[model samples]
Target: MNFTVLVPARLASTRLPNKPLADIAGLPMIVRVAQRAAQSAASAVVVAADHADIVAACAAHGVRAVLTRGDHATGSDRLAEACALLGLDGADTVVNVQGDEPLIEPALIDACAALLQARGDCVMSTAAHAIDHPRELDNPNVVKVVLDAAGRALYFSRAPIPWWRDGRIASTAAALPSPAPLRHIGLYGYRAGFLRRFPALEAAPLERIESLEQLRVLWHGERIAVHVAAHAPGPGVDTPEDLERVRAIFAAV
Candidate 1:
Protein backbone atom coordinates (compact mmCIF):
# COMPACT_ATOMS: atom_id res chain seq x y z
CA MET A 1 0.00 0.00 0.00
CA ASN A 2 3.04 2.25 0.30
CA PHE A 3 3.30 4.55 -2.72
CA THR A 4 4.79 7.90 -3.62
CA VAL A 5 2.85 10.71 -5.25
CA LEU A 6 4.80 12.83 -7.69
CA VAL A 7 3.33 16.13 -8.85
CA PRO A 8 4.96 17.35 -12.06
CA ALA A 9 5.01 21.15 -12.30
CA ARG A 10 6.41 23.52 -14.86
CA LEU A 11 6.38 27.30 -14.59
CA ALA A 12 6.49 27.92 -18.32
CA SER A 13 2.92 27.37 -19.37
CA THR A 14 1.54 28.82 -22.60
CA ARG A 15 -2.00 29.28 -21.38
CA LEU A 16 -1.24 30.47 -17.85
CA PRO A 17 2.28 31.72 -17.35
CA ASN A 18 3.97 30.57 -14.12
CA LYS A 19 0.94 28.39 -13.71
CA PRO A 20 2.33 26.36 -10.80
CA LEU A 21 2.91 29.54 -8.85
CA ALA A 22 -0.57 30.89 -9.54
CA ASP A 23 -2.30 31.79 -6.27
CA ILE A 24 -5.37 29.97 -5.07
CA ALA A 25 -6.73 31.18 -1.73
CA GLY A 26 -3.35 32.62 -0.75
CA LEU A 27 -1.48 29.36 -1.51
CA PRO A 28 0.39 28.56 -4.72
CA MET A 29 -1.57 26.25 -7.02
CA ILE A 30 1.15 23.60 -6.95
CA VAL A 31 1.20 23.75 -3.15
CA ARG A 32 -2.54 23.19 -3.08
CA VAL A 33 -2.14 20.19 -5.36
CA ALA A 34 0.59 18.77 -3.14
CA GLN A 35 -1.55 19.33 -0.05
CA ARG A 36 -4.46 17.45 -1.60
CA ALA A 37 -2.12 14.64 -2.61
CA ALA A 38 -0.79 14.54 0.96
CA GLN A 39 -4.26 13.54 2.08
CA SER A 40 -3.88 10.35 0.02
CA ALA A 41 -2.47 7.03 1.27
CA ALA A 42 0.83 7.75 -0.41
CA SER A 43 3.87 7.28 1.82
CA ALA A 44 5.24 10.54 0.45
CA VAL A 45 4.09 13.38 -1.79
CA VAL A 46 6.62 15.47 -3.68
CA VAL A 47 6.48 18.06 -6.40
CA ALA A 48 8.81 17.55 -9.36
CA ALA A 49 9.36 21.09 -10.53
CA ASP A 50 11.34 22.56 -13.42
CA HIS A 51 12.03 25.85 -11.71
CA ALA A 52 13.64 26.78 -8.42
CA ASP A 53 10.81 29.21 -7.79
CA ILE A 54 8.35 26.34 -7.77
CA VAL A 55 10.66 24.38 -5.46
CA ALA A 56 10.88 27.34 -3.10
CA ALA A 57 7.13 27.78 -3.14
CA CYS A 58 6.57 24.14 -2.22
CA ALA A 59 9.21 24.35 0.47
CA ALA A 60 7.63 27.51 1.86
CA HIS A 61 4.36 25.68 2.25
CA GLY A 62 6.01 22.74 4.08
CA VAL A 63 5.75 20.53 0.99
CA ARG A 64 8.59 18.48 -0.43
CA ALA A 65 9.83 19.13 -3.96
CA VAL A 66 12.63 18.13 -6.29
CA LEU A 67 14.19 20.44 -8.86
CA THR A 68 14.34 18.80 -12.28
CA ARG A 69 15.71 19.84 -15.63
CA GLY A 70 13.64 22.57 -17.28
CA ASP A 71 13.94 21.10 -20.78
CA HIS A 72 11.89 17.92 -20.29
CA ALA A 73 9.62 17.32 -23.27
CA THR A 74 6.79 15.92 -21.14
CA GLY A 75 5.58 15.55 -17.56
CA SER A 76 6.52 11.88 -17.59
CA ASP A 77 10.09 12.85 -18.36
CA ARG A 78 10.13 15.11 -15.31
CA LEU A 79 8.68 12.26 -13.21
CA ALA A 80 11.35 9.86 -14.42
CA GLU A 81 13.99 12.20 -13.08
CA ALA A 82 12.05 12.60 -9.84
CA CYS A 83 11.97 8.82 -9.37
CA ALA A 84 15.74 8.63 -9.82
CA LEU A 85 16.35 11.57 -7.55
CA LEU A 86 14.21 10.03 -4.81
CA GLY A 87 15.90 6.64 -5.23
CA LEU A 88 12.64 4.74 -5.50
CA ASP A 89 13.04 1.00 -5.98
CA GLY A 90 11.89 -0.80 -9.10
CA ALA A 91 8.96 -2.45 -7.29
CA ASP A 92 7.74 0.77 -5.66
CA THR A 93 4.54 2.38 -6.85
CA VAL A 94 4.26 6.05 -7.83
CA VAL A 95 1.22 8.11 -8.68
CA ASN A 96 1.58 11.00 -11.11
CA VAL A 97 -0.59 13.93 -10.06
CA GLN A 98 -0.73 17.04 -12.18
CA GLY A 99 0.19 20.38 -10.56
CA ASP A 100 -2.79 22.21 -12.07
CA GLU A 101 -5.39 20.00 -10.36
CA PRO A 102 -5.71 21.90 -7.10
CA LEU A 103 -8.95 20.17 -6.22
CA ILE A 104 -7.87 16.63 -7.19
CA GLU A 105 -9.48 13.92 -5.07
CA PRO A 106 -7.09 12.15 -2.75
CA ALA A 107 -9.21 9.00 -2.77
CA LEU A 108 -8.89 8.85 -6.55
CA ILE A 109 -5.13 9.07 -6.15
CA ASP A 110 -5.25 6.21 -3.64
CA ALA A 111 -7.45 4.13 -5.91
CA CYS A 112 -5.10 4.44 -8.89
CA ALA A 113 -2.09 3.43 -6.80
CA ALA A 114 -3.86 0.49 -5.18
CA LEU A 115 -5.06 -0.74 -8.57
CA LEU A 116 -1.54 -0.67 -9.97
CA GLN A 117 -0.32 -2.65 -6.98
CA ALA A 118 -3.09 -5.24 -7.44
CA ARG A 119 -2.67 -5.59 -11.19
CA GLY A 120 0.71 -7.17 -11.47
CA ASP A 121 0.15 -7.74 -15.16
CA CYS A 122 -0.16 -4.03 -15.82
CA VAL A 123 2.68 -1.53 -15.78
CA MET A 124 0.43 1.48 -15.10
CA SER A 125 -3.06 2.39 -13.90
CA THR A 126 -5.39 5.36 -14.62
CA ALA A 127 -8.92 6.52 -13.81
CA ALA A 128 -11.84 7.28 -16.13
CA HIS A 129 -15.57 7.90 -15.85
CA ALA A 130 -18.44 7.33 -18.26
CA ILE A 131 -19.36 10.30 -20.42
CA ASP A 132 -22.90 11.58 -19.74
CA HIS A 133 -23.02 14.34 -22.37
CA PRO A 134 -22.85 13.99 -26.13
CA ARG A 135 -21.01 17.28 -26.46
CA GLU A 136 -18.24 15.99 -24.22
CA LEU A 137 -17.87 12.93 -26.42
CA ASP A 138 -17.41 15.17 -29.44
CA ASN A 139 -15.09 17.58 -27.68
CA PRO A 140 -11.50 16.86 -28.73
CA ASN A 141 -10.26 18.26 -25.41
CA VAL A 142 -11.91 15.41 -23.53
CA VAL A 143 -9.81 12.28 -24.12
CA LYS A 144 -11.69 8.99 -24.28
CA VAL A 145 -10.49 5.54 -23.23
CA VAL A 146 -11.89 2.16 -24.22
CA LEU A 147 -11.33 -0.80 -21.91
CA ASP A 148 -11.19 -4.53 -22.43
CA ALA A 149 -13.27 -7.11 -20.52
CA ALA A 150 -10.52 -7.32 -17.88
CA GLY A 151 -10.51 -3.53 -17.43
CA ARG A 152 -7.29 -3.01 -19.35
CA ALA A 153 -7.18 -0.02 -21.69
CA LEU A 154 -7.69 -1.04 -25.31
CA TYR A 155 -7.25 2.41 -26.77
CA PHE A 156 -7.41 6.12 -25.88
CA SER A 157 -8.23 8.88 -28.33
CA ARG A 158 -9.59 12.40 -28.65
CA ALA A 159 -12.19 11.23 -31.14
CA PRO A 160 -15.38 9.69 -29.72
CA ILE A 161 -14.74 5.96 -29.50
CA PRO A 162 -17.03 2.97 -29.55
CA TRP A 163 -18.38 5.16 -32.33
CA TRP A 164 -22.09 4.67 -32.88
CA ARG A 165 -22.02 3.19 -36.36
CA ASP A 166 -25.81 3.12 -36.70
CA GLY A 167 -26.12 6.80 -35.74
CA ARG A 168 -23.50 8.22 -38.06
CA ILE A 169 -24.62 10.96 -40.48
CA ALA A 170 -22.95 13.65 -42.56
CA SER A 171 -19.53 12.96 -40.96
CA THR A 172 -20.90 14.41 -37.71
CA ALA A 173 -21.88 11.79 -35.13
CA ALA A 174 -23.55 13.16 -31.99
CA ALA A 175 -25.06 10.00 -30.59
CA LEU A 176 -24.10 8.64 -27.19
CA PRO A 177 -23.10 4.98 -27.30
CA SER A 178 -25.38 2.49 -25.48
CA PRO A 179 -22.98 1.67 -22.63
CA ALA A 180 -21.63 5.23 -22.38
CA PRO A 181 -18.09 6.10 -23.53
CA LEU A 182 -15.44 6.95 -20.95
CA ARG A 183 -13.68 10.27 -20.47
CA HIS A 184 -10.10 9.61 -19.39
CA ILE A 185 -8.91 11.45 -16.29
CA GLY A 186 -5.29 12.53 -16.38
CA LEU A 187 -4.33 10.86 -13.05
CA TYR A 188 -1.89 7.97 -13.38
CA GLY A 189 -0.10 5.33 -11.27
CA TYR A 190 3.11 3.64 -12.30
CA ARG A 191 5.58 0.99 -11.25
CA ALA A 192 8.66 3.09 -10.60
CA GLY A 193 10.71 0.81 -12.85
CA PHE A 194 8.42 1.12 -15.86
CA LEU A 195 8.08 4.85 -15.29
CA ARG A 196 11.82 5.30 -15.40
CA ARG A 197 12.07 3.50 -18.73
CA PHE A 198 8.96 5.08 -20.28
CA PRO A 199 10.65 8.08 -21.87
CA ALA A 200 12.82 5.78 -24.01
CA LEU A 201 9.89 3.94 -25.62
CA GLU A 202 9.34 4.58 -29.30
CA ALA A 203 6.59 7.08 -29.96
CA ALA A 204 3.53 5.53 -31.57
CA PRO A 205 1.99 7.10 -34.67
CA LEU A 206 -1.40 7.19 -32.97
CA GLU A 207 0.20 8.92 -30.02
CA ARG A 208 1.50 11.73 -32.22
CA ILE A 209 -1.76 12.02 -34.19
CA GLU A 210 -3.98 11.88 -31.12
CA SER A 211 -1.58 13.86 -28.94
CA LEU A 212 -1.89 11.27 -26.17
CA GLU A 213 1.19 9.87 -24.44
CA GLN A 214 -0.43 6.67 -23.06
CA LEU A 215 -0.60 5.23 -26.60
CA ARG A 216 3.15 4.77 -26.59
CA VAL A 217 2.75 2.25 -23.77
CA LEU A 218 0.21 0.27 -25.76
CA TRP A 219 2.39 0.48 -28.85
CA HIS A 220 5.25 -1.10 -26.87
CA GLY A 221 2.94 -3.95 -25.78
CA GLU A 222 2.66 -2.74 -22.19
CA ARG A 223 -0.64 -2.92 -20.34
CA ILE A 224 -2.41 -0.09 -18.45
CA ALA A 225 -5.17 -0.96 -15.99
CA VAL A 226 -8.19 1.35 -16.01
CA HIS A 227 -10.15 2.27 -12.87
CA VAL A 228 -13.73 3.27 -13.71
CA ALA A 229 -14.36 5.94 -11.09
CA ALA A 230 -17.92 6.44 -9.86
CA HIS A 231 -17.91 10.10 -10.89
CA ALA A 232 -15.81 12.53 -12.89
CA PRO A 233 -13.07 14.29 -10.94
CA GLY A 234 -13.10 17.99 -10.06
CA PRO A 235 -12.22 20.49 -12.78
CA GLY A 236 -8.52 20.93 -13.49
CA VAL A 237 -6.76 24.25 -14.14
CA ASP A 238 -5.68 24.76 -17.74
CA THR A 239 -6.60 28.37 -18.56
CA PRO A 240 -7.40 31.66 -16.83
CA GLU A 241 -11.05 30.67 -16.69
CA ASP A 242 -10.22 27.28 -15.17
CA LEU A 243 -7.97 28.94 -12.59
CA GLU A 244 -10.68 31.36 -11.65
CA ARG A 245 -13.21 28.55 -11.30
CA VAL A 246 -10.85 26.59 -9.02
CA ARG A 247 -10.01 29.74 -7.07
CA ALA A 248 -13.69 30.44 -6.44
CA ILE A 249 -14.17 26.88 -5.19
CA PHE A 250 -11.20 27.12 -2.85
CA ALA A 251 -12.21 30.56 -1.65
CA ALA A 252 -15.67 29.31 -0.76
CA VAL A 253 -14.15 26.46 1.22
Candidate 2:
Protein backbone atom coordinates (compact mmCIF):
# COMPACT_ATOMS: atom_id res chain seq x y z
CA MET A 1 0.00 0.00 0.00
CA ASN A 2 3.03 2.25 0.50
CA PHE A 3 3.78 4.34 -2.59
CA THR A 4 5.54 7.55 -3.54
CA VAL A 5 4.14 10.16 -5.92
CA LEU A 6 6.73 11.76 -8.20
CA VAL A 7 5.76 14.93 -10.02
CA PRO A 8 8.02 15.69 -12.99
CA ALA A 9 8.32 19.42 -13.55
CA ARG A 10 10.33 21.51 -16.00
CA LEU A 11 10.50 25.25 -16.62
CA ALA A 12 10.92 24.91 -20.39
CA SER A 13 7.50 24.78 -22.02
CA THR A 14 6.74 25.91 -25.57
CA ARG A 15 3.04 26.54 -25.04
CA LEU A 16 3.27 28.37 -21.72
CA PRO A 17 6.80 29.46 -20.84
CA ASN A 18 8.03 28.53 -17.35
CA LYS A 19 4.87 26.48 -17.04
CA PRO A 20 5.72 24.76 -13.77
CA LEU A 21 6.32 28.11 -12.10
CA ALA A 22 3.16 29.62 -13.60
CA ASP A 23 1.02 31.14 -10.85
CA ILE A 24 -2.22 29.40 -9.95
CA ALA A 25 -4.12 31.53 -7.47
CA GLY A 26 -1.27 32.26 -4.98
CA LEU A 27 0.76 29.09 -5.56
CA PRO A 28 2.90 27.87 -8.45
CA MET A 29 1.31 25.23 -10.68
CA ILE A 30 3.91 22.65 -9.63
CA VAL A 31 3.19 23.41 -5.98
CA ARG A 32 -0.51 22.97 -6.57
CA VAL A 33 0.11 19.61 -8.25
CA ALA A 34 2.32 18.43 -5.40
CA GLN A 35 -0.27 19.54 -2.88
CA ARG A 36 -2.95 17.50 -4.63
CA ALA A 37 -0.72 14.47 -4.85
CA ALA A 38 -0.03 14.76 -1.14
CA GLN A 39 -3.74 14.16 -0.52
CA SER A 40 -3.34 10.67 -1.96
CA ALA A 41 -2.32 7.55 -0.02
CA ALA A 42 1.31 7.91 -1.08
CA SER A 43 3.88 7.46 1.68
CA ALA A 44 5.66 10.49 0.21
CA VAL A 45 5.12 13.02 -2.61
CA VAL A 46 8.10 14.70 -4.26
CA VAL A 47 8.57 16.94 -7.26
CA ALA A 48 11.30 15.87 -9.70
CA ALA A 49 12.19 19.15 -11.32
CA ASP A 50 14.51 20.01 -14.21
CA HIS A 51 15.17 23.63 -13.29
CA ALA A 52 16.57 25.14 -10.10
CA ASP A 53 13.73 27.67 -10.12
CA ILE A 54 11.18 24.85 -10.11
CA VAL A 55 12.96 23.18 -7.17
CA ALA A 56 13.07 26.50 -5.33
CA ALA A 57 9.37 27.13 -5.93
CA CYS A 58 8.50 23.70 -4.54
CA ALA A 59 10.71 24.33 -1.50
CA ALA A 60 9.09 27.72 -0.89
CA HIS A 61 5.72 25.99 -0.86
CA GLY A 62 7.00 23.32 1.60
CA VAL A 63 7.00 20.59 -1.05
CA ARG A 64 9.98 18.24 -1.24
CA ALA A 65 11.76 18.32 -4.61
CA VAL A 66 14.94 17.08 -6.24
CA LEU A 67 16.98 18.62 -9.03
CA THR A 68 17.05 16.27 -12.03
CA ARG A 69 19.05 16.57 -15.24
CA GLY A 70 17.40 19.10 -17.51
CA ASP A 71 18.29 17.14 -20.64
CA HIS A 72 15.93 14.25 -19.91
CA ALA A 73 13.94 13.38 -23.04
CA THR A 74 10.77 12.45 -21.17
CA GLY A 75 9.15 12.64 -17.75
CA SER A 76 9.81 8.94 -17.22
CA ASP A 77 13.51 9.54 -17.70
CA ARG A 78 13.41 12.38 -15.19
CA LEU A 79 11.54 10.18 -12.72
CA ALA A 80 14.07 7.39 -13.20
CA GLU A 81 16.76 9.78 -12.05
CA ALA A 82 14.51 10.80 -9.16
CA CYS A 83 14.06 7.18 -8.11
CA ALA A 84 17.81 6.84 -7.86
CA LEU A 85 18.07 10.13 -6.00
CA LEU A 86 15.45 8.99 -3.49
CA GLY A 87 17.01 5.51 -3.21
CA LEU A 88 13.66 3.85 -3.67
CA ASP A 89 13.65 0.09 -3.24
CA GLY A 90 13.12 -2.02 -6.35
CA ALA A 91 9.81 -3.40 -5.09
CA ASP A 92 8.48 0.03 -4.11
CA THR A 93 5.59 1.62 -6.00
CA VAL A 94 6.09 5.05 -7.62
CA VAL A 95 3.19 6.91 -9.14
CA ASN A 96 4.07 9.39 -11.89
CA VAL A 97 1.87 12.44 -11.39
CA GLN A 98 2.33 15.12 -14.06
CA GLY A 99 3.22 18.54 -12.61
CA ASP A 100 0.69 20.27 -14.87
CA GLU A 101 -2.21 18.26 -13.40
CA PRO A 102 -3.07 20.45 -10.44
CA LEU A 103 -6.70 19.36 -10.67
CA ILE A 104 -5.89 15.59 -10.59
CA GLU A 105 -8.09 13.60 -8.22
CA PRO A 106 -6.23 12.08 -5.24
CA ALA A 107 -8.46 9.02 -5.35
CA LEU A 108 -7.40 8.40 -8.96
CA ILE A 109 -3.75 8.55 -7.94
CA ASP A 110 -4.42 6.08 -5.13
CA ALA A 111 -6.31 3.80 -7.47
CA CYS A 112 -3.43 3.67 -9.97
CA ALA A 113 -0.97 2.80 -7.19
CA ALA A 114 -3.25 0.19 -5.67
CA LEU A 115 -3.82 -1.42 -9.05
CA LEU A 116 -0.09 -1.67 -9.68
CA GLN A 117 0.36 -3.21 -6.23
CA ALA A 118 -2.34 -5.77 -6.91
CA ARG A 119 -1.16 -6.70 -10.41
CA GLY A 120 2.22 -8.22 -9.71
CA ASP A 121 2.27 -9.53 -13.27
CA CYS A 122 2.23 -6.00 -14.63
CA VAL A 123 5.17 -3.60 -14.51
CA MET A 124 3.00 -0.47 -14.69
CA SER A 125 -0.60 0.66 -14.17
CA THR A 126 -2.76 3.47 -15.57
CA ALA A 127 -6.36 4.59 -15.74
CA ALA A 128 -9.11 5.03 -18.33
CA HIS A 129 -12.79 5.98 -18.48
CA ALA A 130 -15.66 5.13 -20.81
CA ILE A 131 -15.85 7.73 -23.57
CA ASP A 132 -19.37 9.17 -23.45
CA HIS A 133 -18.94 11.58 -26.37
CA PRO A 134 -19.17 10.33 -29.94
CA ARG A 135 -16.97 13.12 -31.27
CA GLU A 136 -14.08 11.97 -29.07
CA LEU A 137 -13.74 8.80 -31.15
CA ASP A 138 -12.47 10.87 -34.06
CA ASN A 139 -10.50 13.33 -31.95
CA PRO A 140 -6.80 12.43 -32.07
CA ASN A 141 -6.17 14.61 -29.04
CA VAL A 142 -8.09 12.13 -26.91
CA VAL A 143 -5.93 8.99 -26.72
CA LYS A 144 -7.79 5.69 -26.76
CA VAL A 145 -6.88 2.35 -25.20
CA VAL A 146 -8.16 -1.15 -25.97
CA LEU A 147 -7.93 -3.55 -23.04
CA ASP A 148 -7.98 -7.34 -22.78
CA ALA A 149 -10.58 -9.25 -20.80
CA ALA A 150 -8.35 -9.02 -17.72
CA GLY A 151 -8.16 -5.21 -18.05
CA ARG A 152 -4.61 -5.09 -19.33
CA ALA A 153 -4.00 -2.60 -22.13
CA LEU A 154 -3.65 -4.26 -25.53
CA TYR A 155 -2.69 -1.00 -27.19
CA PHE A 156 -2.88 2.79 -26.90
CA SER A 157 -3.42 4.98 -29.93
CA ARG A 158 -4.89 8.17 -31.33
CA ALA A 159 -6.96 6.25 -33.86
CA PRO A 160 -10.46 4.97 -33.06
CA ILE A 161 -9.66 1.47 -31.85
CA PRO A 162 -12.02 -1.45 -31.64
CA TRP A 163 -13.53 0.29 -34.65
CA TRP A 164 -17.21 -0.42 -35.10
CA ARG A 165 -17.57 -2.57 -38.22
CA ASP A 166 -21.32 -2.17 -38.57
CA GLY A 167 -21.05 1.51 -37.74
CA ARG A 168 -18.59 2.16 -40.59
CA ILE A 169 -21.29 3.92 -42.65
CA ALA A 170 -21.32 7.73 -42.25
CA SER A 171 -24.84 7.70 -40.77
CA THR A 172 -23.87 5.21 -38.05
CA ALA A 173 -20.32 6.58 -37.56
CA ALA A 174 -21.47 8.76 -34.68
CA ALA A 175 -22.71 5.83 -32.67
CA LEU A 176 -20.45 4.54 -29.91
CA PRO A 177 -19.09 1.00 -30.00
CA SER A 178 -21.09 -1.84 -28.38
CA PRO A 179 -19.01 -1.48 -25.24
CA ALA A 180 -17.76 2.11 -25.15
CA PRO A 181 -14.11 2.53 -26.10
CA LEU A 182 -12.07 3.79 -23.15
CA ARG A 183 -10.39 7.19 -23.15
CA HIS A 184 -6.86 6.76 -21.84
CA ILE A 185 -5.97 8.74 -18.72
CA GLY A 186 -2.43 10.06 -18.38
CA LEU A 187 -2.08 8.96 -14.75
CA TYR A 188 0.43 6.14 -14.30
CA GLY A 189 2.02 3.94 -11.60
CA TYR A 190 5.31 2.09 -11.90
CA ARG A 191 7.38 -0.32 -9.86
CA ALA A 192 10.67 1.29 -8.85
CA GLY A 193 12.65 -1.44 -10.60
CA PHE A 194 10.78 -1.11 -13.91
CA LEU A 195 10.92 2.68 -13.70
CA ARG A 196 14.67 2.53 -13.34
CA ARG A 197 14.89 0.24 -16.33
CA PHE A 198 12.49 2.33 -18.41
CA PRO A 199 15.00 4.86 -19.65
CA ALA A 200 17.20 2.15 -21.10
CA LEU A 201 14.44 0.56 -23.17
CA GLU A 202 14.77 1.38 -26.84
CA ALA A 203 12.08 3.73 -28.08
CA ALA A 204 9.46 1.72 -29.90
CA PRO A 205 8.43 2.59 -33.47
CA LEU A 206 4.81 2.76 -32.34
CA GLU A 207 5.84 5.12 -29.56
CA ARG A 208 7.53 7.51 -31.97
CA ILE A 209 4.69 7.26 -34.49
CA GLU A 210 1.88 7.90 -31.99
CA SER A 211 4.02 10.15 -29.78
CA LEU A 212 3.02 8.01 -26.79
CA GLU A 213 5.70 6.75 -24.37
CA GLN A 214 3.63 3.91 -22.91
CA LEU A 215 3.91 2.07 -26.22
CA ARG A 216 7.57 1.42 -25.48
CA VAL A 217 6.59 -0.67 -22.47
CA LEU A 218 4.17 -2.73 -24.51
CA TRP A 219 6.67 -3.11 -27.35
CA HIS A 220 9.18 -4.51 -24.88
CA GLY A 221 6.67 -7.21 -23.90
CA GLU A 222 5.69 -5.62 -20.60
CA ARG A 223 2.20 -5.57 -19.15
CA ILE A 224 0.38 -2.41 -18.00
CA ALA A 225 -2.70 -2.87 -15.83
CA VAL A 226 -5.56 -0.56 -16.69
CA HIS A 227 -8.00 0.71 -14.03
CA VAL A 228 -11.32 1.77 -15.57
CA ALA A 229 -12.47 4.77 -13.56
CA ALA A 230 -16.14 5.66 -13.09
CA HIS A 231 -15.67 9.30 -14.00
CA ALA A 232 -13.30 11.38 -16.13
CA PRO A 233 -10.42 13.24 -14.50
CA GLY A 234 -10.20 17.02 -14.29
CA PRO A 235 -8.58 19.10 -17.03
CA GLY A 236 -4.79 19.53 -17.02
CA VAL A 237 -2.89 22.71 -17.88
CA ASP A 238 -1.55 22.51 -21.45
CA THR A 239 -2.22 25.78 -23.25
CA PRO A 240 -3.02 29.34 -22.17
CA GLU A 241 -6.72 28.57 -22.44
CA ASP A 242 -6.29 25.45 -20.31
CA LEU A 243 -4.40 27.49 -17.71
CA GLU A 244 -7.14 30.09 -17.61
CA ARG A 245 -9.81 27.42 -17.24
CA VAL A 246 -7.95 25.77 -14.37
CA ARG A 247 -7.39 29.15 -12.73
CA ALA A 248 -11.10 29.85 -12.87
CA ILE A 249 -11.83 26.49 -11.28
CA PHE A 250 -9.32 27.16 -8.50
CA ALA A 251 -10.63 30.69 -7.95
CA ALA A 252 -14.14 29.33 -7.52
CA VAL A 253 -12.86 26.85 -4.91
| Per-candidate local distance difference test | 0.93, 0.93
Q: What's model 2's TM-score?
A: 0.97
RMSD vs true structure, all candidates: 1.7, 1.4
TM-score of each: 0.97, 0.97
User: Per-residue lDDT of 1-253 in model 1, one digit per residue for the tens?
Assistant: 8999999999998999999999999999999999999999999999999999999999998999999999999999999999999998598999999999988999999999999999999999999999888888878998999999999999999987978778752225455668989999999999999999999888999899999999999999999999999999999999999999998998798
Stretch of 10 with least lDDT, candidate 2: 166-175
Segments of candidate 1 deviating more than 4 angstroms: 169-175
Score candidate 1 by TM-score against the native.
0.97
lDDT comparing candidate 1 with the true structure: 0.93
Candidate 2, residues 132-176: lDDT per residue as tens digits? Answer: 877787789999999998999999999888788776523235567
